[model samples]
Target: MRTWYEGAIRGFGMLVLLSGVGLAGATAARAASLDPAMLPKIQAATFEVVQAKPTGDTLSYERPLPLELLPYQERTDKYYSIGTAFAIGHNRYVTAGHVLLAGEASLWGPPELRDAAGRVYPIGKIEKFSLGKDFVVFTLAQPPAGDAALEVDASPALNQVVYAVGNALGTGVVIRDGLYTSDTPEQENGAWKWMRFSAAASPGNSGGPLLDKDGKLIGVVLMKSANENLNYALPIHEVLDAPSGNAEMESRIAYQLDLFDTVENSQLKARFALPVGLGDFYREFQSRIDANSDAQLKALLARESANLFPSGAGSARLLHQQTQLDGFPTLIVRGSDGEWRRAGGQAQRFALDGNGYVATGAVANNGLVRLRRPDGVAAATFYGDAKSRMDLLARTGMFQRAVAGEKVKITSLGKPVRESTHLDRWRRPWHVAVWPLPYANALVMAYSLPVPDGSVMLVRFTPPAHEHDTMLDLAEISSFVHVTYQGTLAQWKDFLGNPALQPATLKGIRIDFDYDHRFSYTSPRVAFSYPSTLQAVKPDNLLWLGFRFFLDGGKPVWDVGDVNVWKDTASDDHNNVNVQRYVAPPPGLDDDLSGRWRKLAEREYPYNGVARYENDLMKINAVVAPAAAGSQPSTVLYTAFYGTAGTQPQADMKGKLDLLTKDMRVTEH
Candidate 1:
């Protein structure tokens, strides 16, 4: 069961080496004793019953024309819907990061998958989805019957006959066969390359299943090619065996809340979008599916049916208000008129006060009713406008005080906004503004303001409540500043020595970055020399520009400036302008710099401006004058890095390293 070195074929004729064993590319002969009827049974067994939705606008493939052997034969030129997904234990599934995220994300490689019944399920918990490797793991709110899920097997034989099962071009479940080609080296979104025998795969098959001859799970069907037989798959085991993150249910829920929190300093919640509140409940549900204990699953379902609300709020009212989803618990509160009510409970009071506060709470089993306070509202407001009400609640430590109190001075940490807020002309880019430090309660928010044309002013903000003592300290926040002069590793040493910046002591450091380069040149043809040969001679010579930056863990980290080569489009040329702009900032300061730059771009450019400058660095090109072209070098590029700096020199120090230069023969762009 060990994964063969020649893992399997992937990405349109691409072959890859598996992690454990090496084998020849010769295809395995079909098992002569294999039962053809088993194909459907095996297909059912090997196939993972997926319950999913499009991460975006996936093409809905048309069914095969009435008489054709192929499903999309007539629709070849048209688009088909596709999605990415994975199996959970034995009867569940998962998908890519983008699938469940809505809005602009649909443009990116979003989530796309469906259940056995052809019913699309709402993505529930995206426990582990990462752009670093272009993989995501999620669960459906409800599980579908009939089709069972597949398990992940890390090891597989090389040169094995493998088949992929997917909703190719929306033609239902299509099975394609292929060989395990190779495993991608280093880090890449298409982590493991796959190549297959059948041509059934299309863009819609990504994250599908690639099974072995015996129908045991093997890899995930991902990429495909125009040539009918070429396709790729990600090794299934690698995905399952990869690190399981520590993201918790509450944290994830809080993460979701943060997305719409309207709080100025919330980024963690914004970056990742998934169901946070119900993640744990869904996890428990998934556990039931994996164990195959239908009775236990039913028991869990009964728990789900248990009232989340208190009694006397109306038991029959709640009983008549239930809505059932296939996988998860659904309760729809309704009005006396029978129309579905969006409110949580039946007897709840709803009103928005001048302070924009709403009050609601449920009674506990102890007969004590508890009050739910709206975010950012003063506690004193619970018993009128007096602060004594808050003190009383504090002393009572009881959340169930609906009694009226005298006019009290109400206070809170600070008022929160319902709408998005921006700080114009900030000190640094907004992206890296705040970071959760080692100490609890302590936060390091950095910003950069536009200085002169070529420079930027950087600054850091620690909340006023950041007490030096550990008594109130949560996480001790720190920063690192590394600056590279123009893109050379030598800049690393230079920034390390600068007096203005100090690297944070002991803990690890990272670099964030932003860079821009522009150039122009004319074609290399002399005037009048081509007059007679105008019909045969080409006038314009292609002008090219290139750029690149080194990044690790999405953060510009180490120094590998030594990996130099001829600057091509992929390396750094006219074709790679977009790539050039994606430079990772040098350790420490890069994070802050990126954030500051993002804010600046948001303010200066505003609305959709981020799309224009999405790259970590940017490059522009134009034709140079022929005479000046000879005088000037054909290649030019810029490099930069930032590290640590700030008030708590021992903690908040971060900086950057940068440089710009030209290439004659073409080296690192």
Candidate 2:
């Protein structure tokens, strides 16, 4: 079915005209007018329903215009002509419910109508509206003088010649003649039927009055079927024959508003809060299982189960453990009975057992466990860390491909439904959504909760058939699952007993050097040893001194060590180094420099200042010392070796940095 908005045109092709034989009777009747005597009255009653400053909040009802036509089309302050409304009584006007509801969310003001002479009339309080029937009636705040209401025909007959009068494409109200073809039941609620016609009602003809040969109102034009000339209208008697009491109308309005609010809220939540891509995984897995033979499917499930519940871990004793996952720090705790358990941020805790690791809270399936309901629904939860940024949209698209597989056609079932972020009993925030799978008989629901240290846990539930409502099941499972950490038994053993985990051991490094070229760099407040092959370059502002180093090939390298000694710079009081810089101190000297310098360095640099920065391209180190008793100022010695950001400098390069900063001195100029 197509809406009346011009934008609702779905394709670029011109409208295909149906054979004239089917519409011959109506075409001949057009010359005789519905009624020559009532023509003037019908024209006067019909007005162009133009909404100036159309509300922007509502979704666009029109189809995207072709790129070529867009440039020549005039930009209008007015939205599409919302079909048409005609005076039914002294000041009462009637139109389609959809036309008004489309703008109800962001309507600028009261809707207004324009007559053939270009006179505008404002609409007043809506007298009645019914979403079920797609009809609305309101009073004109200022009725046009001598504008009599159109008479309503309680009955409209099929095959009878009729006239459709309304603004066609916003040009003006034009009466089009056609024959009443047949009636079809409304799709949503089949309690009533719609009158089909062969009239050429365009985008602006919706809500216009459908008149019998006598010029009496028979129905209201609403929409047309795509690929055919068949149009539809609501019987006029449904509105005129119904009671017009304010209480009944108000009740109907309230019902429609409540329903609309629910739908809008659901759509908004889905757009922003729900986790994406889970549906694709579940759908694909289901399709794979369905296509395989029963024996093969069982084998597949067994393999998945094994991967999810590996047996190598068995059970292990707890020892001192230090590990980070999903941005959260975790600890290994030993129970009185000697069994080990992991616990830390976000209620992350799991028992070490041979029966497969079970979470203290929500179940953290090991990515392979296939969950099945008595109803044949299968579910799986995949755990992954967002350690490196991953595009959610791209991930979801990949899942779509998996589900579509080799031959099945996939159709989107509207948009995904999003629910508000709900906190589980463990107090973890989870984003959830229920998505209809492209499959004819299945639905996939999923929720994702955050883990510490930049990680995410996703759980997906897929029902066996689309008929099943898995929403409640998803909610129950998600609420019960707890965050958990899993690892091999060896990893746990090393975590608990390894002395290398100690802070001092982790930060310690040793260096020895044999210098090829050595010279002292002396500034006003400090002096440092650097390679004589390095060229000293002074900054234009004299804020610091730079030593340019070269590779063996004599190509100039930009990674240079800089020294700055200034009495007034705030950083002078405390050794300051950019986080990107690497620093390394001699084994025992880590705490030897008055303890103050060591404390500051450790607090500001990674690896507690032992190494300020190290990457594949280079490694850097710095040393700072305060001046004696009333000397000039504190001094800083900095050095770097060629390397990349993700790797460490070679042993030879490391030794150079140690020797370069060795013998660094702070003395008064």
Candidate 3:
């Protein structure tokens, strides 16, 4: 997904498509004689650029293979090979500016030089740089022991034989020969020119020196046209002749780098925070793994696996595998012998061998079974369901196929347990059953709960005889499983119509604000909580609701104050609550807030000891309380309405307001 300018090679072909502009035919220039004596001086001037300790993290897309297979290739700690640089002036070197700035904020580190003998010389400061021209000039703290500097030639004729020397892929310094192809104007402006060549250039060839036959430096190789041998280099005259006294260049570089840093931070926040669509979520997850170092990648994968299976009583060790099918996240569960896979794009079908077992089509694969029961039986099964009535005698044949022709009896059955949580109303119903299989010497317990759209979630538990006294709580394990429906109604109906199958969308469930911590603002005077889902307009100054109802249009509805809380009015309603705290004004300003209560006893209409005020726009409930004895009074005000004068407060708005007001308390300074 990276663009051509982003230094990724996949989009390099586009460069050739744009190469035909502003080029004209010219006669080839005569070749100059090679100076054998100058070869040693040119080689001595060339050095490999390296970053000993990189400050920025390196992000790579290629998946790493085992390095042990190639014993000769050893991994190095060096994070960046920013192409090559050579001495242009006394203790001065020049390189392609992009080699230093290509990755945005993802590229950072103090640059140094690795000479032919492996000696490192650190760069002292940046002397000059031109981002548009892709060239930089810097001085070294300690110059290498070489007095020779390549003289810059401002003009090179077309088709002149040139020598390109630089570190190729960071392997070593290499010299390649080719003809100076032509000239083209720089893309940004016609103020500068580029020397086109037919020389070979790879990633690490950037910032290297382009030398004429007489060994005079003419251009600095910057990039190669994608899908062709045509390479581009910036004339060395630009770097040598550019004004070095420009006062704003340093600040400009800092500003651009800072922008890149901000973008990287935003990307990290989106990956770990917020709800992204299915495709983006998977891509972001994979990209993180690919970018991480070996040690970091391994740790992240292990943590992800642990989240899929949490430890609890009677919990089965299920192997989980996930893949995207039809752009939706699909999950596969594997047991000892049986495994689940997609069947005809409708539902998941379990392929079980002779050792596997199944209950009725309605409650298939929902529960676990035990090989042994507490009564020392050979085999037993436990089953639970939310949809079916809790009757032990009616479902005795639930596991008839598993223990074929064997005797089994229902030992005990529990009443259906109704469950409710903060996120949903009390509608979940489930029951448990324990059965003994004498032929197999095992006990089975089945527990099930109803899922969305009239489907049942079942769990089967089979514990050993000694652990029989310590019953495994199947209800607790079932509570953690989450099922989501993504298909159309016809597809959903088709899935529900088939009792023997389940959808592949059943996997780890995510809850809003479950993984994210609340954004809390605490000062010496006050403190409160707001869901992390809200975008902070001025962080602690204002918070905006990320989503809107049908009536809200596209405008941002938000709140501002020391501590505030906002919630939807009700189910299928557009109204919401906006609570703000107002501290009592100085002695002279009390008259402006005419309806504000001075104390709890002054109000005639007080519900649960909180005063109320009503206007055409909203209903305000205020509770005046002191921060401490003899301190100024503070009023916690709860207002229920929607967007300036849009909708009336719902009938139960006061009840919801009271819940938020109860948590609002004055803090001691």
TM-score of 1: 0.29
List model 2 lDDT by residue over 37-122, tens digit each. 78678777887665554332211112332323322222432433455778888888888765554343122333467665667777
Local error of candidate 3 at residue 374 (angstroms): 28
In candidate 3, what are the lDDT values of residues 66-96, reduced to their tens digit?
Answer: 4334223223333345567889878888887
Better of 1 and 3 by TM-score: 3
- Name the lDDT of candidate 2: 0.42
Error of 1 at 194 (Å): 6.7
lDDT of each: 0.30, 0.42, 0.42
lDDT of 2 at 395: 19
| lDDT accuracy of residue 605 in candidate 3 | 49
What TM-score would every model get versus the actual structure? 0.29, 0.37, 0.37
Compose the digit string of candidate 1's lDDT tens values, residues 496-516. Answer: 333222212101222211112
Report how far off residue 415 is in candidate 3 (Å).
Answer: 45
